[model samples]
Target chain A: MKIALDAMGGDFAPQAAVAGAVLAAQQLAGKAQVVLIGTEEAVRPLLQEYGPAAATLELVPSTQVIEMGEHPAKAFQQKPDSSIAVGYRLLHSGTVEAFCSAGNTGAMLVGAMFTVKAVPGVLRPAIANFVPKLDGGMGIMLDVGANADCKPEMLEQFGELGSLYAQYVLGIARPKVGLMSLGEEEGKGSAVTQAAHQLLKVNPHVHFIGNLEGRDLFNDKADVIVCDGFTGNVILKMAESMYDIMVTRQLDDEFFARVNYETIGGSPILGINDNAIIGHGVSTPRAICNMLMQGYQMAYAGIVDQIKDSFKS
Target chain B: MKIALDAMGGDFAPQAAVAGAVLAAQQLAGKAQVVLIGTEEAVRPLLQEYGPAAATLELVPSTQVIEMGEHPAKAFQQKPDSSIAVGYRLLHSGTVEAFCSAGNTGAMLVGAMFTVKAVPGVLRPAIANFVPKLDGGMGIMLDVGANADCKPEMLEQFGELGSLYAQYVLGIARPKVGLMSLGEEEGKGSAVTQAAHQLLKVNPHVHFIGNLEGRDLFNDKADVIVCDGFTGNVILKMAESMYDIMVTRQLDDEFFARVNYETIGGSPILGINDNAIIGHGVSTPRAICNMLMQGYQMAYAGIVDQIKDSFKS
Candidate 1:
């Protein structure tokens, strides 16, 4: 299997992306290869500095670079030769099984939707993040920032999408799906949540576990929690900030350490035809490695095909 | 000043309430008196155990109790003699300057709306929680769980309400108000947030600071962050769970230690006709004391009157 990495993405891009590609290549040797897409001149020196492990890397030079602050849709359309744009082109043309970026999230989302397109029967694609569970496990949460204002049907789809990702990608045998709400009761939450809960309850594809509250976020309550992007995004950032605070205050602990974005690397944009992972813009070498590893795992697991099959059934 | 305590509310109930009343009585002295409403038989003995500190306590026997699981509006109507209901009555009848409880949150909200009512010109009343900032100061966030689905106008009001609370109750001279969004940009939130941002930007009453992302929750970026109740509640509970995880992991530090709900005590139900503080259901005696102290501060500061004046203009 081959995964394309956007070398021009992220704050420490080119260098971090090169190092991550090198590390991922070493870790997934014989199993997968990485195609680093970026300006050859900028990436070659770093690849040489990283030494022997960089041997597995295949650089696909792309001249254009998408800055972090650029409009995603516009940049993806205008900068066809940008690393992110080139990476998407490779995935779309079946040159690479997956593409991952830590660059402009908007551009990544735009590229995924416009390039590979959304899965059939999918209302909208969702981006899912892993919640580091207290039980030394992880739970998948979807619509982390994709569709801010979601309808009941959209959220119901998210439950199925999250469940499939949990089972196929996260390897949870029977992913317990939950609707993230203010209260645990069925009647609680906004009109959207209440309507979504009703629809999710009868959805045979997902093992819906009713409603889960905020307290259950890091607990072993549910394997997949679905919420509107607005709510999910807030929870995701708040959780991220919590880890930041812990680090700033030097409250180093095993669980808190796992809360770092570097551990999970990036979130996958589910319901898309092809696999695409989005990393934090400030992703380090380790984060990049994990993100690439995640891409390799998703590609190897054939999650996209499985989701399509599930939707068909 | 007179403050009413729902003695029969919360998991620990009469014991914690009586203890808190005693503590508050001692702390307030000539400044204020506490009126504990509950079954005389259950509260009197606990108050007696605490001795001299209970001198400023005035017991108002309530015959009923609102269980945590009961319907808020229905319970308030059915159990008119319940501690929460009677406490509201005291505040409504001007028998007490303020009312507080750690009971069924919905019941308290129902009682506040039915009895004291929302201040004139207020779209909806909001509950504001204190976010302990990393800078050793605190910020206020509103609509924590009151109105799950809010209009742009309501969020605009929340900004004003949160700002006033910060200035008057929290003692911030010019509370900088921020609209909590997925991104920090002007047009980066849900439709409601976008519209609210436009309204907040020109609302001269508030020190509108554009948009604040979830990462700014514990930071010193804004003194008051406003969002819809649904998003606000999720963030609040998520933050609470973060603290719970820290405690469970024994990750003790100055900042993490300050994350304790006991430190801030309770959240005030803002935009109401009178001050009403709501504590966590499982609040300890210390939490209860802090809650009552918060109620005392709100009443003493004449926050409700100031809010009324602001709305009138």
Candidate 2:
């Protein structure tokens, strides 16, 4: 099996991406091979610095790089041989079991839509982010930024998608799914969330735990929290900010430490046809390596097939 | 100015309320008076516990109490003599400059609509919560839980309302108002937020700073953050939960400590004819005291009159 990384992606691209891919290659040696996609001129030098470790990494050449500020859709279309576009191509062709990138989040998401596409019965794909629980272990929340404005049905599907991620990738036996809302009561949310609640409750695929307030995010209440991208994005950013503040203050408590983006690595675009994860823009080598590990877990779990099976009806 | 409180409010009521009111009475001694409204049977005994310090407090008796679980509108209407209802009546009849309560949040909101009412030209009233800024001051966000759903116009008004609260009550000059959204760009939010973003930008009433992400809440980016009740409520609760986690871990960082609801005491119902604050359900004596002091500040600032003047056209 081959797991790919966009070597030209992220702030410290080529350097951090090449180094991290080398690390993942070392760890996934027996299980899967690591592939790097980038312009040969940029990646070869960084790969050379890794010496023999670089020998384990497969470098696939591309001529262009989709910049951080470029329009995702246009850039992906016009720069067909760009690292992101080429990475997606590899993903679509099943040449790589999973594709990971730390650059151009919008482009990565746009690439997902244009390439591997959504699962057959899935309404839309959602970006599922991990939540560090207070009691240890991890939970997942979906639609972090994939679809900012979602219908009730989309939110319902996010629940199914996130639950599948938790159960398959994260190894939660029967992930408890929950709808994020303003209040704990069934009726205490916007019209969309209220409607989504009923859909999730009756959905047989998940262990629906009902509506959860923002305070419930870090608790033991739910393992798979579902919300529209707008709400989930707000939460994801807010949590990141809190962790950043802790870092600034130099407070190193265990639970808050896990709140760091680097700890969780990246968010996976769920409900899609294949495994793809989008890392933070300022991802360090460690973050990049962890993202690759997560991608490996997702692909190894066969989570995309699981989603297709669950939503087939 | 007389600032009224519901003695029967909060989980530790009459006791905490009376103690908190007595504390406020001493603090507001020469400037304003503290008024407590509850059944004489419930409040008189608690006031007696404060000794002569309680003498400074003016006791306004009521016949009923609004339980936390009762319907807000029905309870406010049926229990006309309930503490919250009586407090609203005192506010509407000019007997008190402001009213504060820790009991039955729904009843307080219902009573506000029934009595003092939304200020003319204000689309809807919003509940405003204070964000403890990392820079040693306070910023405010509105529609925390007042209206679960809001229109573009309502969100625009929330910007105006929150800006006014920041300027007058918080003593910030030309408070920067930012619409909370998934992204900072003008085109970056849900349909309503995007529409609201344009409304806020063109409105001459506020110092519009464009859109803000959830991470901007505690930062100096926006002095007043405008968001729908659903988003604001989720952010507020999420902040509270983080504070609780810090406490559980015994991480006594000063900045995170301010995230505690008790530190801010209460959230005020803005865009109304009179100043009314809703306290935490688990209000401590200190929290209740801070809320009353805040009531005194709002009354002293004549915030309601300022809001009326701003919207008079």
Candidate 3:
């Protein structure tokens, strides 16, 4: 299967992206084809630095690169020939089996959603990030800023999606799903969270584990933590900030730094029809490599298909 | 100045609270008096453990104690003579200079607000927690759950109150204030947070450091991290969960047995008319003592007066 890569994405675009592609190609040993999408002028030089893998890798030339700070939806529209837009189009047209990017997150989400569209019966695309907890198990946080406002039904769907993703991808059977709320009790949180909590608790498919307050999230009590995009994004940012602060304090600097940069290989964007993954824009070769592998595993598992099946009931 | 202590509050009640009061009295050296409020039968034995320091501490009898799982608002109505309710009333009636408890958080906040009332011009009372950061300085997060839906004006007020508390208590001048949002950009969060961002940017009295996402709360990027109670509580609980998860794994024992307990200190309830501090219910002797001392400092610093002045503008 051929995977489309956004070569011109992120602060260290082309160079880091291309290097990561080469590394992944080497690791996969051509079992999977890497198709780099970007302008040849910018990418060829970076590709040449790789020496051998550069020649073996395929290049699909695109003219523009979306800047990180640019308005995401508008940028994708204006820069139709940009790597993200082009790569997404390839995925849409079925030329590529999956797509990955370390570009503007907003742009990537917009490109993936508008171009590829959501799977049938799915409410909206959700971005799930792996948060490293001390339990040796990661907490899957969903809708980590895909859509800000979510209905109760949408939240239930997110819980189901998160549960399935955890079970199939993270290898947790009957993964316990908890709705993020203010308190773990029956009548905790705002109207939205409360309603969602009730829905998830009663849903037969999801291993609904009642409401989990922010404090309960890190416990091994729940494998999948579901919240609206706004709260999820806030939680994600909080975890990221803590890691940064802890590392900056020089507390086991290398350990936390590796945990911060290396452990979280990538955040898979679930709910879409195709295999679309978005890695940290500040992707090191290692993080990108992890994302590539994660994408491969996710594609093989047919998580999207499982998600579709989840909605069937 | 005299302080009323709810000895019957918290899981370790009477014992830890009595010990803390005795320690506080010794530390203060007759500067502040301690008035323990609880059932005489339950408190007398615990006070005996303090030896001579118990002589300086007096007891005011109360028949009931609010349980951890009890409904806070109704508990006061059902048992007005409950130690927490009575202690707050003592503070309200000017019979005591301050009241300290390690009781039901909701009950504490309710008693304090319904009895002592908010300092003049304060829209709402907020629960502020000091997050120990790598910078050696603590980041104070306010409105951790007191008021979920806050207006831009209220957030500005929260920022000012948080800043004032940080300045007087923590001794930071022009304390940096950050509005918590989904992202750090100028227009990145929900309407409330985004608008609060704009207002904070223009507010001159505040150090207004602009928008801070949840991740930045743990970092020393700012001294005061402000958010509505709903979001703030979520972040607080999430961080708390992180601490719990880490401690449990590090100790590898039963959850409660694994907790350091020593670090589970009290959270100061800001914006009340009087110096009233609330500790976590499961607090240890050290945390309760620290909070008692904190209550003394807050009372002596004329924190309410300073808060009164900051909001006058």
Candidate 4:
């Protein structure tokens, strides 16, 4: 299997992307191949600088680079040869099993929707992030910013998607799926949440654990928490900011340290026909390496087929 | 001015509530009077244990108590003589300038809306909570859980209410109000937030600073942030949980120490006819004391009249 890395994306650009690819290639040597996607001139120098690990990495050059600030839909349409577009093209054409980027998140989403498309019977594809738990485990949360406005059905679908991710990738057997709500009671949320709660409660595919509040975010109460994108994004950003505040105050603690973006690396866009992972824009080389590893893991797990099968039944 | 406290509310009720009222009465002296509202049998013993400070307290006996688990609207309607309902009745009749409770939050909201009512010209009443900032300052966020769904106009009104609270109660001059959004860009949120950003940006009354993301919650960028109840509630609870996580881990950091609910006490129901503060249900004596002090400050600031005058213009 081959995992395509967007070399032109993120603040660190080709340097961090190339270094990450080399590291991923070395670590994932017989399991998967890492393909760096960017301009040949820019990526070649970084690959050379990475020394012997570069020998294991394969380079797939593209002509254009999408600016971080450009509109995703417009950029993807205008820059056909851009790294993100080219990477999507490779994934769509079966040249790579997965495509990963730390670029314009909108462009990645737009590309995934137009190129690989959503899995059959899926209402809307969702992106999920890892929530570090206090019990020395990790939980998964979905639609962090993928769909800012979601209907009740979308939220219900998120529960299924999140549950699958936890079970297959995180190895949580019978993952407890929960609706992110304002309170613990059954009818204690917005209209969307209340309706979604009913849907999730009856859904046979998920191990529904009722409702979980913000206080249960980092606890071991739920293995997979589902929410609309707006709420999930706020929770995600707030958690990130907590880590930032802890670092700025120089408070050295194990739990806060685990909150770093570098530790989780990237989130996978679930429900899509093919695997697509998105990393932080300010990703370090280590973060990039983890993202590549995550992309490899997602493809190896055959998540796309698993989701397709789940939705089919 | 007289402030009413619900002695039957909270986990350590009667004891914590009575002790808190005594503390407030002593600290406030001639500035304001504290009235304890509950059954005489439950509050008298606790007040007596408080000794001399208890002598200055006023007790308005009520027959019923609203349990924490009871439905808010139904309980407020069924138990008309409950401490929360009686407190509202006193506030409505001008017998008390402000009312506060560590009881059922829903009951308090129901009472505030049904009894005292929203200030004229206010689209919707909002509840606010204090957010401890990294710069050793405090910021106010509104609509923490008042209305699960809000219109663009309601969000615009929240900007005014939050700003007034910050300016008068919090003592920040010309408080910068920001629309809580997923991103800083104008078009970077759900449809409601985008519309709210436009409304808040053009409203001449507020010092609108455009859109603020979740990271800005603890920063000094905005003195007051306005969001719909759903988003605001999630952010508020997430912050509270952050404090909880820090405590459980025993981080012992100065910033984390400030995140204590005891320091902030309670949130006021803004845009209402009279001052109404809601404390944590598991509040301690220190938290109760702060809640009563906040009630005194809200009444002392004459926030209700100020909001009425501002909206009338």
Q: Name the candidate, 2 or 4, with the larger DockQ value.
A: 2
Q: Which ten contiguous residues of candidate 1 chain A have the minimum total lDDT?
A: A243-252
Expressed as tens digits, the lDDT of each residue in B1-313 for candidate 3 is 8877889888888788888888777887768888889998998887787678678888999998888889989987888889988898888888988788888888988887788888888888888877765545677888888776678888988898899888898888779999877777887887777788888888887898888877676457899988888787888776766556545445232322212334535677888788888887787777777777787778887888898877674
Ranking by TM-score: 2, 1, 4, 3
Q: Quote the positional error of residue A194 for candidate 3 in Å.
A: 0.9
lDDT per residue for candidate 2 within A1-313, as digits (tens), equals 9999999999999788988898888889899999999999999988888789889899899999999988889999999999999999999999999999998999999999999899999989999899999789899999898888889999988988888888888899999999999988888999999999999889888899999999999999999999989999999999999989988998888888898888898999998899999999999988999999999999999999999999998
Alpha-carbon deviation at B201 in model 1, angstroms: 0.7
Clashing pairs in 4: none
Best by DockQ: 2
Give candidate 2's error at residue A8 in angstroms. 0.8
Which residue pairs collide in model 2, if any?
none
Tens-digit lDDT string for candidate 1 (B236-279): 88888888887777777887667788888898999999989899
TM-score of chain B of 2: 0.98
Query: Which candidate would rank higher by lDDT, 3 or 4?
Result: 4
RMSD of model 2, in Å? Answer: 0.9
Candidate 3 stretches with Cα past 4 Å from truth are A53-56, A133-135, A248-261, B245-264, B309-313
Q: What lDDT score belongs to each candidate, Candidate 1 first?
A: 0.90, 0.92, 0.80, 0.91
lDDT for residue A246 in candidate 1, whole number 0-100: 73
Best of the two (1, 4) by TM-score: 1
Chain A TM-scores, all candidates? Answer: 0.99, 0.99, 0.94, 0.98
- Give the top-scoring candidate (lDDT): 2
